[model samples]
Target: MHVYADPFWLPKQGNTEEEYEDACCPRKVTERASCSFRCAVADGATETSFSGLWAGLLVQAFGSGRLTSKRRQETLRSLQGRWLSQVSAHPLPWFAEEKARCGAFSSLLGLELGEASICGGGRWWRACAVGDSCLVQMRGDAILSSFPIRDSRAFNNRPLLLSSNPGRNKEATTMWTSRGGTWESEDAFYLMTDALACWFLTEAEKGQQPWRRLRDPQTGDGTFAELIAELRRNGRMRNDDVTLLRVTVD
Candidate 1:
């Protein structure tokens, strides 16, 4: 099977792009090709300190398979140590230090796709999520599956998140939910951060296929920026760091 993946993202309306806190692994865009791959996205909570760094590390750890069930807690502790080390290297104000002590928080979603001979020689994908970040599978014009958080109303400002402070995150491993399924040649999968995810679900609830808009080949950074600009202009979508990753199985 050929796999193609691309990501489009934009910062909140008033924020500079540098201020965008969401992060994704396999950061480079992917063209249609035959290969097995893993990817992940993390949205850092704005109220936390060094959240972007925490988010980036989480995705990289997950995408590299370092965050496995057996090593989940151990890996998280290592990552937390790394975060603290990085933070200590830079000078921080008193308030920043206070926030650092409290820890950074971020929502995470991880995905792995490969050819599965066990399933009668078909392509299959497995996904794990900690919060509102979502994965939706589509076959042609219909959405076949929605994981972790299915309903639009289910999304709120607060979501269970992974913390950079391991001491306060005893349930980190248990809080994640995972699902796996097979996919056909033409199936498409989307991983989205909270803002765009909420809008995607709301549109789906209205019996609309928002994926069509996202899957268009012409959709790129500029396209996404314009669409998000209009959505914010019309007040249809919340103004937040928006990210969307599309993976097509062919």
Candidate 2:
């Protein structure tokens, strides 16, 4: 199978792009070619301190295969220790320090995909997630699977998240969900942050093929910016850091 993946993102209106806190690994913009790989996206919680850094670490750990179910707690504790070390390097104001002591939080979605002989020689994908970031599997124009969060209404402001504080995040150790499936040539999968995910599902509920628009080659930086601007203006999509990672199997 021939595999291609790309990632696109835009920060909320009026915010500098650097202010965008979401992070991904095997990043959308990566140029490497590989038949088997791990990828992930993390959405940092705006209310938490150093959340972007926490999100980045989470994705990197998962993509590197160091954060599996058996190693979950150990890895998380290691991550927390590293984050604390990083925080200690910089001086923080009183309030920022207070928040830092409380730790950061983020939503995570991870995927592992490969051409496998086990599933009768087809391409297979496995996904794990905590929170609202979504993975959608499609064959042709129809959606074959939606994982972690399924319904459009499930895309609420509050989603269960992974935290940088291992002691405070019991749910991350136990509540993550995983799913696996096989795909044929021409199958497609999408991993999206909450806002764009909500829009995708809403459009699907209305019988619209949102993937066609998403998969278009013209959906680059400028086009995505325009589309997101219009969607936010029309109140169709929430104004947040939006991200989409598309993986196609051919």
Candidate 3:
């Protein structure tokens, strides 16, 4: 199978790119032929300290297949330790230390695509999600499925999130969900952080072809940052770190 994967992202208004608290795996555009592929997007909670780093680790683990459904709690428990080690290697101020004790949190969504020759010679995909970060599978002019959060109205400031503290993760891990489906030649999958995802779902619910907007972004000056700025200014999208990973199979 031939796959094309592209990631677009922008930091929140007033926040430099360095402060963007979101992460994506395979953080580059690529087109290639392969039997399988793994991709993931994570949105770090800005309220927590070191959330960006925790988000990065989550995506890396997901993309590398280290995080899976089997023994998921154990896998995540190990990952939480890794997050702590990285964050606590140096001393922190009293305030930062207190925040660290509460721990970082992030939303995680991971997708895996591959050939399923044994299942009647077709392509297939599976995904898992921990929060509002969403995956929408498209075929032709319609969306085949949407994961984690389907309705735009379902979104809110509070969302279940993966935590960098093991003691606080049992609920999040238990709430994680998974889905699978067969892939078609012209299928496209869009993975997005909560802000862009809510907008996408809202537009679709209105009977508008939101996928078209994403597939062919009309960025001013041909830059995603400009497009995101426009969206935030017009109230079409929320003002937050935005990320989208579009993967097409042929």
lDDT of 1 by residue, 121-217 (tens): 6678889899889999999988888988899999998787899987656574578899999888888889999989889999999998898889988
The local lDDT score (0 to 100) that residue 167 gets in candidate 2 is 64
Superposing every Cα of model 1 onto the true structure, what RMSD results? Answer: 1.8
lDDT per model vs. reference: 0.87, 0.86, 0.89
With a 3 Å backbone cut-off (N, CA, C), the pairs that clash in candidate 2 are none
Query: Which stretch of 10 consecutive residues in model 3 shows the poorest summed lDDT?
Result: 217-226
**Which pairs, if any, clash in model 1?**
none
Compute each candidate's TM-score over C-alphas: 0.95, 0.94, 0.94
The weakest ten consecutive residues by lDDT in model 1 span 115-124
Candidate 3 runs further than 4 Å off: 118-121, 171-173, 217-222
Q: After TM-score superposition, what is the CA distance of residue 217 in candidate 3 from its true location, in Å?
A: 7.2
What is candidate 3's TM-score against the reference? Answer: 0.94
What candidate 2 gets wrong by more than 4 Å, as runs, is 28-35, 118-122, 171-173
Which TM-score value belongs to model 2? Answer: 0.94
lDDT of 3 at 118: 39
Ranking by lDDT: 3, 1, 2
Candidate 3 colliding pairs: none
Off by over 4 Å in 1: 32-35, 118-121
lDDT, model 2? 0.86
TM-score rank, highest first?
1, 3, 2
